[model samples]
Target: MTPLLSWLTAVLVGVAPPPPGRTRELSTRDRELLAVCQTDQFRRVDVRIASIVEWRERRGRPYRTIPPDASLPEGHIAFTFDDGPDERATPKIRALLAACGVYGHFFIPGTRVGGPKARWAIAELKGLLAEGHIIGTHSATHPSFTRGVVTSRDRRRELDRGREALEATLDIHPVLFRLPYGEGHWDSEVLFEISRAGLVDLHWNITSDDAKDKAPKEPGFQGLTADEVLARIERSLDFSRRPGERLGHGVLVVHDTNYRIAALLPTLLNRLVTRGYTFVRFVGPLVEGRDAEEDTGVPRRD
Candidate 1:
């Protein structure tokens, strides 16, 4: 979903990049295809995948193995931002996270680190490290990991490239990966590749649905007042509830490109806090690549 941030990232051949390529004039057909590909319906393929997963568990094939509460308190929360390290709003969020004294995870683009729009992303990541926030890979170029859709070999190369780039730029080997669009058959082929790369695939408990949205076209939202986008995103938090199931902690996912994200942060954080949720970063062995996450949260009773 955050494909641009992931794909347009820095390459490992020493950050001194080639002269930028000339912009190609895109046809109307190209633009239409781009919009359709980025829509919610296109991404719902992942939802179907998840539903099938939940169903498999119904048939006695458990997919997740949620961790026991090991001296952890109830209502521990974590705020994670994906498709980041932008010179734009990412650092702002990091600063806010720092003020809250909560350690969150930043899933950054490996190649984009030293690039123009996100060169500061590397510095921000360094600051995050100093402040105890964990760093994870969002993929080398943010491409699909689907086997037939994108050759498995290419997926490995891209993932490994990302891992290497993140380590080189940020000086820390990334331990977690949020698959591009959160798509992939996590139990088989994708898992095999992730395991070999020594990284765990991390997905969100709550998504802000920021990627699928296109900015307003008329007058470019020049004088819009208040935080409409944030209000919509706040509604996403409602999806985190699981009735009688102990949902464990929540990791909220949002993009750096959202309009008024900074303005909405205080209100959202305030609401989550009012609900007794405190931010807590992932620290399982799976994230460290010792073993993959058998389960990321508590499953429902059949």
Candidate 2:
């Protein structure tokens, strides 16, 4: 192995630190060496992977569920939007949620807020906060950390930069993070980075599959229609619930960047309400000590 690959292999196996004078940046040659490590031919290393939820539960910090009430017959259901702060779709989604009198958790990519559309993105994020929605980091540039292509330094940078950008801009310290593409949820390295950053990683048990791209000649040529998305969500809910359980609880994920989902959000929300599902916010280490019901309440916007 070359010195760089050897060093990386050692690092992956928990044996060594970065070589001297190579801590801050990778040289062109070093980049090529790293690329070699990312190839499919490269042998995958075995590391202790851990599920964040199980880890939290083991520590007695099990995520709290929003129980059913008289008005909402079904148990808790939290809505999470990823890969967003879109110029068009996001605002419409916010408006739709506002109309439905429910709040959502939006996981935004740091680059979107700090990039060229920083002004609009910042304003949009602020608006979401003002309207009582919760926001979390989705990482800077949304890289897939479990792919072996991401270095330790890259992981730290992704987590820290994304968090710092939001804190600096919003003057709020976010305690929640969701992995890009929902990858690395159980990777020890990824979990360590998240814990080191003092952020709890949130993973969804239910998904709308709204982010999925439709194949050529698919019914909804661009994306899945509202009915299709609803069907997928219902099926997931059915599978997750017990045989005799009347209500189900889970975090449902969608993308705010998808206009189809945004536009049809009301239909989904109404259907969910009619089906006795109560919209709730994620609660646990992410919002320690805060009641999910209180968190779900309307925010007092100035």
Candidate 3:
């Protein structure tokens, strides 16, 4: 039987045998086969993928610049974090975001959700979702999306598998994505792969430059202090402003991989609030509510 026909048969039988050693985690090909099998169940897949392709073909700008009026809050600014669900730092960060009544977009890799021995990250992910923060797929294993050596097929797997893993764990599929390391070129193949997965690329206009602190360099490397990082963020916000420019939206990128930024999150949020900026959740594509149970053989209990 053809792949589609086989997958359809499996779906009808209600027992599609998973690949060897991957009973929980669905591979990219598995998702494709399933997508082909239950076209009605995934009717939105083609439309969403087409939207991504059209956006890529047009070289669509970041999601912030075109915020729908209804989604905008007074003094809007989007706070996005990457490379997380950090065990030591995420709970603290979640508390901080909660105290401030602001939502952050956490772009996470599937690997961080933990394995058999440890399962704290999955709890943290669930907590983040429970607290009303938006989660976006960072990648399956946080690979560099812009490196020329990474093939398009691998990139698609990263996007598709990551989404599958997250949806299985959180029970909600995410439609927002960011390449690992925030690396991308205009109209790159990586972008097309992202578009193929029915996700919107949410890039940041401002970076906290916190990675410098995380890089344990030799003495005199001169990394920015938390204050300096906040200053850089301030400058970025200023640069985006024009004389008589309306309070348009912008996305700020920060990391939760280390404690430096997490420790200083209060300072950053305070500055923004004091400056009349309202923290707003990202308004983009999302999977509405939970779906049916999925056995993500990847073992992390939530």
Candidate 4:
């Protein structure tokens, strides 16, 4: 083999091979191209340090980024529940959170948490907020903007209804919104609606994906056998986080209304508490106290 090629191979093998099917690794030719564009490593690190210093100076502290603030620290994971205020299930979700001495951000359907339903559940939500839990909106009905869930007009109506329901119930409305099914087809109208509603798009970094797996009678989940669901939730947590390390920040996307989640919440929260994480609600930057401006169109209450 040519000495030049041998050296190149050694350098490539020295660090670490990229994972299979991952295209992010530096290809030999691409890396060689970079040699012409190379900047000093120490200089790069210095630039990063300076950038962080300047950012901290202006923003006080940046959110959801590496080299987190000394105050916020790193490795803290936030728990956020979606599509809830489930009369039967939400109480249990709340109780588990209380027992753990940690609270989560709850994304509620405005209809469920409003009107007569609000009469019953809003009190519980108030207790949650009182205890530092956060509430965000998850649309008025559990409709989806995805092509599979419902028609476009129906989807718009659902969001519009949620906005009204939230305003009627909470009075302040919600400023945070998450898509149904943990994913959405983004477009100009979606962007316009989000902006007009004055809502921040709240989403998850970790989802159990158990909502799609409702077949408890099947192998993975079982009827009344909540352990299976609990186990999967645990596994999701494990896969999403590193143990004994400071994560500084992460958002765990979990469900409340799903019966399987009834068993899952307690165990995961307990495990998380034991891990030295203080459960903070994964609220976006536009919470009520964070704002002093007029309503933007999005419902602010969950």
Candidate 5:
């Protein structure tokens, strides 16, 4: 196998040895990303960083958010993947989720789902849906919707065009949407456009920090290692808990575009399950007033 693929396999199979001793460096962007994860503001379990229910109440936007389901027992969590379906990484992730008897919500860009260049990705999306996973639109070009970055007309196009492409190709209407980079998430106009599209906007309370660029072009952008990614996720899970709670329950975000996240998914899922967490989807039977245990066949832990 290629060295990169070999490393990924080793990680998944739990046989990879630690890397040899080498100098570690961080680029400005790398530091910035890491710093954001370390900040008190970023770590808070408030509307700005955590629960979608809190965001909906605070923002008072017309857009729909996932409501808190009392039917879902404590220790229930959902996995949401953004910026997929990657050619190599997505299938690996789907397999891992399937093996664990869980499903995930995938937010994919329209650009990756249409035309001849994306045939493989189209096939992957179909497989994911067939396997009981949920699909949502990320956007057409994966552009930031932050105010002034694009005109209002362009923002509408970004939302409409993405849902349109997916419908035309997959014949599936995705009711869920997520802002690229979570930018414009709180923007009024952006929320209006999303609401106007008849879609529900989804955000995460926990982040895996797996989206950092690992390319070697920059002087010191070594990006986060697999261990570091897992560590960040553990920290976020801890920070997401409320007072007097044994564990937190909410959406967790990761990127399928980053193959490393897929490689480490087995380890991550194992840890969560061992901690008595039940896996769930963001929508469908779990959140649609049905018992999660009956719908997903994933038993609730006491």
Candidate 6:
């Protein structure tokens, strides 16, 4: 087959031919491309020669890049949740936040909303927006954007399709994105794609480690109970340990999909409140005193 035909065939099958002289050490672009070809995003769409041409034209140019601001106040923390809209966990999590009078940034999986098995997810999603919570794309499905196994195209699909899913379901476009597994494997090209997609990359500096139970059964993998998780968070709040560190300021990560998070959040919030950490949502930028403007706050799907 001709090279172009070979490439098309690979995409159709959710694979990307490794670059020439490909090895375990893949270049950033190659890794991004591989991720794009290997992920489930493309398989959900109808691929055609014309569509490929359009993608080529629009590849580097993202169609909502909202950059976040850097002026968060002291004692302010942004609580971000990922891999959710899960029925068992999401509603409880929402109620807890509401009771606490705080908001969270929910990075939702695109596939879960409006999927055959997750029709209820749309309502959960809308409920989040209605209740003054922030939403953003975690991906069409959660995958490591930096893993060598997927391609840049896969990364793009992850960003665009996930946003499209949100816009379609909620009638609001989001510009915030969280790397599925955080920043472990991130590189320049991945950052470029984030800009190309017009998204501000939001990674966390503090963790609740609330998903400890989800860890695989391997070495150094013990689970934490709700009380232990609270203790871990408390330890992280010790400003004396890292004096010059962003004292009283953090982008805290926790997973809503984790049952532990839903169970422990109330306790966690109470502890943080007692410690004087104020909860705030990232609405593109951090507004110092009051809530973010409505345009940047909870969006109405209408």
- Which numbered prediction scores highest in lDDT against the true structure? 5
- Lowest-scoring 10 consecutive residues by lDDT in candidate 4? 41-50
> What is the full ranking by lDDT, best candidate first?
5, 2, 6, 3, 1, 4
Q: Global lDDT for candidate 5?
A: 0.65
lDDT of each: 0.53, 0.63, 0.59, 0.51, 0.65, 0.60
TM-score of candidate 1 relative to the true fold = 0.64
lDDT of 6 by residue, 71-130 (tens): 344666677888887654677677666655677889888888855846778888788888
Please write out the lDDT profile of model 3 over residues 130-216, one tens digit for every residue. 776778888888877767327878888888888887877777667778777777634456666675676656777666677775334
Residues forming the 10-long window of minimal summed lDDT in candidate 3: 41-50
Per-candidate TM-score against the hidden true structure: 0.64, 0.68, 0.67, 0.60, 0.71, 0.67
Candidate 5's residue-wise lDDT over 187-255, tens digit each? 666776776775656777788777676753321223477788889989988877777888877778888
Q: Once superposed on the true structure, which residue ranges of model 3 sit more than 4 Å away at CA? A: 1-74, 116-118, 214-223, 246-248, 283-302
CA shift of 120, model 5, Å? 0.8
Alpha-carbon RMSD of each model: 14.5, 18.7, 17.9, 20.2, 11.4, 18.3
Steric clash pairs (candidate 5):
27-220
Highest TM-score model number: 5
Candidate 5 clash figure, as a count: 1
lDDT of 2 at 48: 11
Q: Which of the two candidates, 1 or 2, achieves a greater TM-score against the reference?
A: 2
Worst 10 residues of 1 by lDDT: 43-52
What lDDT tens digits, residue by residue, belong to model 4 across residues 1-302? 87546644655666322112111233344333333222221010001111221111213422222121212223456666777765545665665555445556677777677566668676666666666566677777776666544554665666667666756665545555666665462343443454345454556555566566545333222233467656665565555555565443455676765645655555555455445454444333443344322232222443
